[model samples]
Target chain A: MIAEIASVSFIGGLLSLDVSAWGQIMVSRPIVCGPLIGLLLGDLKTGLIIGVLLELIWINVISVGAAIPPDATIVAVTCTTLIILTESKLSLGSDFHGSYRMVVLALTMPLAEFFKTIDVKQRKLNARFVHYLDREILKGNLKAVGKVNNFSLFLVFLRGFLFSLVAISVGVYILPKLFSYLPYAMLVGLNFAYRLMPALGLAIAFNTFRGL
Target chain B: MQNLGFLYILVPVLDKLYPEKEKRIQSYRRHLEFFNSHPYFANVLVGIVARLEEEMAKEGEVKSEEISAVKMSMGGAFGGIGDSLFWGAWRPFTALVACVLVIIFLGKWEGAWLGPVIFLFLYNFLHFHTRFKGVLEGYEKKTKVVRLLKKMYYLRTIWSSHVVGLTLVLLTGLVVLFRDWEAIERLYFLAFFLSIILLNRWRISAARLLYLLIGISCVGGYIF
Candidate 1:
């Protein structure tokens, strides 16, 4: 489990980098990163299902100028990792659209909101790094500029790694037990809602595109 | 990330243009002022700024204030256009297409890995290709990138329309698959769809809308 968390969190860091650390590559997107993590966890279906769902709903969320959208990449990596890991431990069957998955999905949405606040704080800290660079430049320390920029990227990477590590670690312990207590009928409803979620996802996608 | 990301572009360009130490320092300082825009769209401005800086260094034809003016003016426009087209349209369109492909080929868990591979390949191909191309066009052609952006607007429209069609088809597939759904369930689905559209139109946050959906679905679960 430690090995899995470490490796997956590293990948999370890389994808999180796509949000701002480097190229605006779409790799950080849920559709891409979620499946990739799922593949690593030996459950491609879990990853793809979660990825596609998150991609559909959060399709319009973006970092336009100063506004930071929820860190969908972290949400993707953390949720997919937790879902697959928990399922393997519980010896659950390969029903990717089951109620357990829906419960996990429900729990994951708010997690993105939490991580987004962390991201805002990290950017604020990065602003201080920028100021430090400005002072270094004033002192004719051109070489320091590269170090400062690289350090900022490192900070973001570290933040991603730690967040993923903690989120997945906690999620694996909480999600299964939480769902295990639900009534059979409620589980059935969750499964139904899980199936119906794609419609809402598609509607969100349509709302986004219609505005275009 | 936005400010630092652009520094990578500006530093090298400024380095090549300004050989004098003092001049290079001035160039760096000038650019270090707060600048933010959509990252992908910022490439065009980076290209344009590189060109303007080159003009300033080589012929002194452009004033510093004019370059700053160009950056300020183009920043908001690019942000709006880039957000609308790339974030609003292109991403959702490709994602919907990917989702449809996944449903078609791997819905039953057969060869599921292929879905993510296709999605990553298709999205990155469009994303990085246009990103680099935007920079090149902005650098080589400067203001003429507007024409290219106009072309992009048409492409975005075409792609978005296709996504809408694909989504409707997928929704139809759902209705067909669940033919045995209770009448109340069907009505609930209709209400869910309508509420999503109406709430989205009213500009509710996606997260909040999702929370509402989940809450309502959970309560409906007990009643049904």
Candidate 2:
């Protein structure tokens, strides 16, 4: 549970900080984060594997204007993590691994979308926090800076823990049933996402480049 | 290499637009090398360089060649290009295309990891090599980048759109080939292409048509 909690906070903190707070790093991106979470859960291979698809597919899902990305990497990582944690591989002696993995992916995707909206809303509300940080910077107040950074990191992790918990929980509950029913439609939808989503990624990357 | 590829597309834009001293270009080239050496920071590094150049111009340390009017005449032109090429064309083309390839081949997820790392190699190689070429001769960098872009026969914006279109087409093809998806998607694609043809005839801007198509699809997809 602690590991799970830490994983979510690191992600949430990095995400919230990327475009909104310090804007210092985008390395915390899905390509980076997916492998990371996989390692944290003691499954580096799975993390690296999922990271690859999510990274390539959504490489251009960087921060832009008012628009928020569908967060492909987060979806990949969350889905993978949830699956590996709850379902056992051959070494783990769990017979339900195959079904669990598939069901988790199916369940975790919608959960990812739900959390994205929440993150976007949080970002919008962060305007005042941004102003406050700016003022503290202007005043050169170390105490203020330290306080804000610490508090923000805490809040970010708290949010991640809650989101991850709910997401994983819901995945465990109804995923197997739903997956059995709509595997066909879901496969089609994912294929659609994989191909078309890349184009969307290009639109994003191009939009960020300076006009010649 | 993807970053390097992007550099070929962009840094030449900077050199042609700025045309600064040998030292600046040399320093700039070094900076690009540093930027691309790290896999993820390539575009952001370019953006940082652009910002720094702008600041240098403001301080009267350097003169603006083409980017001079960036604030006034450029009208967010540089920003738009950066956004388009880095975020839009190079990143997505490098990324999503690979994603499509992975799924199209039905590769195992583990094997698909090469897509991004491959991009990294492509970008860095191109970035450093082009910079070195630029410092060796005047206009050399411009010639090289232009040639690269030309051979690709693709503008960044257009290329980005093409990636999107191709990926969508592939996805649709896969869906049809693999499983019985709702038959409605076929109708939806037909309607989308038809509307695009009709709208283009009326001379609606492509951007507007994009939004219109999306809007129409969402609404139509919902009802039908």
Candidate 3:
């Protein structure tokens, strides 16, 4: 299970890198990556559910220009993986529809902000590489240009892989323990939030189209 | 990395334009400056650059400054347009449909995988097509891409309403899934929907409203 989790995390990281690290391909979007991880876990349904939720919620949060938005790929991938894995370990039964998944999602929300900071740091590091490439361009060193470009992509891949690896590693132990103690009332709220979050996400999406 | 991505797209063109090492280096430097644009419309910028570079290579009438000026000016304006068009309109349109499917198949394993697959197909179809065509069109027609995009304004309007309609369907699905909704709770749901629409109409930040709704749900948990 550990080996499987690590490999899946690595792939998820690579896809997440697709958002901007290389091509602005739509593969890294939550609608895709979430179910991708779920498919890897042998449960495409979990991935689809979480993917739709995160994709809708973060529909407006795009990386426009220099501004870095919260990394939804990481959130969707991690949350889906954690929930599915945790459910498997505990045998969370076949009747899993509401609170359990919602709790996992609620817990994973903070990681989006946490990973955003990491994303910003990665970009800042890429800035240094860009500066180095600038000098390489001056020297007409095409070899160095390719090297730097490849290295930057590698760095992004590494950032995502390591982040997910660490998140899932830590979460594997912590989430189950934490879930036992989370109040019933809080879970109820999460279930409500689960319902409300879609509308809220849609509202945000609608806000973007206001001028049109 | 999107800043660097522009260089990648231009590398082949740069190599083709400047045969001499010194000329190539100079051309490379011209494009290596800080660049960030809406990813989809970047094709337009790339297309324009490709054309300008071609002109520079053939006629030498197009100065590097003119090229740089176009890059600087067009990037921001087109970035705005692309953001609103692709990110704002196209994405939400696809996502709303995808979300509706997820809601429809909330617990059905057989049907669950369909939503994300459809989403990727629809979105990438639009996303990649625009990217490829934007570049080709920009390269072929140059500044006329703006007018071309202007002609598509009605499409944007139509897509916007699709988003609104899909959103209402999603909200309706949520309300249906609640199992037992009292009259007052139904009214609150209606108010919640209206308030968000109104807040958006007034141009209040949706982020603030999102946080407020989350907070209300969190604090109001005890009441309901």
Candidate 4:
């Protein structure tokens, strides 16, 4: 149980730092961070590959001054997680191609983004949190704000991590049913994602040279 | 340093309150050195500090004299640097870079133990090689290794990141060329990248590039 708790908390700690401290590094990005974490949970290669797809399609996604761009972190992590689950299941014995799994997640990312707007509302608490910290610190009452920060960071981490865990778990559990509904385009989309990355990278470079 | 993590401030506070003054002070002043010793341990050290502080102040939780002084000092001195480096830059960059690389290279199901493994290895060993040299550590300062590392640190990291980005682009190109209509999709994405650079160089701004990028986005779908 401690392992589970630690897993949740680790996700929380990571999420806390994503916006607050670790924004400078791209480790928190789904491609890198998701795969790294996925490696821990096993199936790192799939995580890495899926991450590449998300990274390209949403290359410009970023939170800017006072604006929370969609939670690509969740979108990425959740999708990768599903791919891992589905791929492994198919690999084991199922007569299925797991590629459709990520396709579903890809389709759902916008929905996930819609739900994640709730995070921006929590952003409103930043000022009040700072005020609380100041008042407590001045009063020599470290407990008030320290606990607040700790708990706030915990919840911040928990919400995304849990949401992801549940979403992935549910998606993984139900993929066989969803497989029935998918069109041929799903396979093409997956195939496109597989190649889209290198194309974008070269384009970025070629364009850089041409303009220069 | 991408940014100093809030953990920086945490370390010094723990150092001040620590029952053992000497080790704590030494570790505090030479925190990076200690970190060079072990990242996981350093994280544990961070956890210890927070947990100890909580344990010490559980109930009515009157702040101790030493803890209060440390807190007062923390807000003014350590907190700023910690906030700036960790919050403002370093941690975000590190976290994002790490996560992004993992996602791209490894994916959600796949993984890259090497990346983090190399990170841990380099973090612990590279910065502290002089320790093995001991007395020579003083003399070896005569070499350019320190500056060399610093320079390499500057160039190699940026170089590597660009490589990752470039690789992504190339992958996208091959995929497009093969998967979709040969000529149209190829030319469209070609034009997309061309425009990205032109826009950036001309100061066309992202707002305007949106029109062009929208067309480019469609190219991916068209290729499919």
Best by DockQ: 1
- DockQ for candidate 1, C-alpha atoms: 0.53
- Can you write out model 1's per-residue Cα lDDT over A67-135, one digit (the tens) per residue? 877878898898899888887655445563467777877788787888889888988898888888888
TM-score per model over all chains: 0.89, 0.48, 0.85, 0.51
What ranges in model 4 sit over 4 Å off?
Answer: A1-16, A19-26, A56-67, A88-102, A111-116, A134-140, A173-176, A185-193, A201-212, B1-224
Alpha-carbon RMSD of each model:
2.9, 11.7, 3.6, 10.9
RMSD of 3: 3.6
Worst 10 residues of 2 chain B by lDDT: B31-40
lDDT agreement with native, every candidate: 0.77, 0.45, 0.74, 0.45
Pairs in steric clash, model 1: none
Isolated chain B TM-score per model: 0.80, 0.35, 0.77, 0.32
lDDT, candidate 4, A118-208, per-residue tens? 6766655654565555455455444443466566666677666666566656766676566656555544544443333444433434343
lDDT of 1 by residue, B35-67 (tens): 777677788999898998999999999999988
Interface RMSD, model 1, angstroms: 2.6
Interface RMSD of 4: 9.3
Name the regions of candidate 3 deviating beyond 4 angstroms: A91-97, A183-212, B1-3, B153-159, B162-171, B174-224
Candidate 2: regions farther than 4 A off: A1-36, A39-64, A89-103, A133-162, A169-212, B1-75, B100-112, B119-224
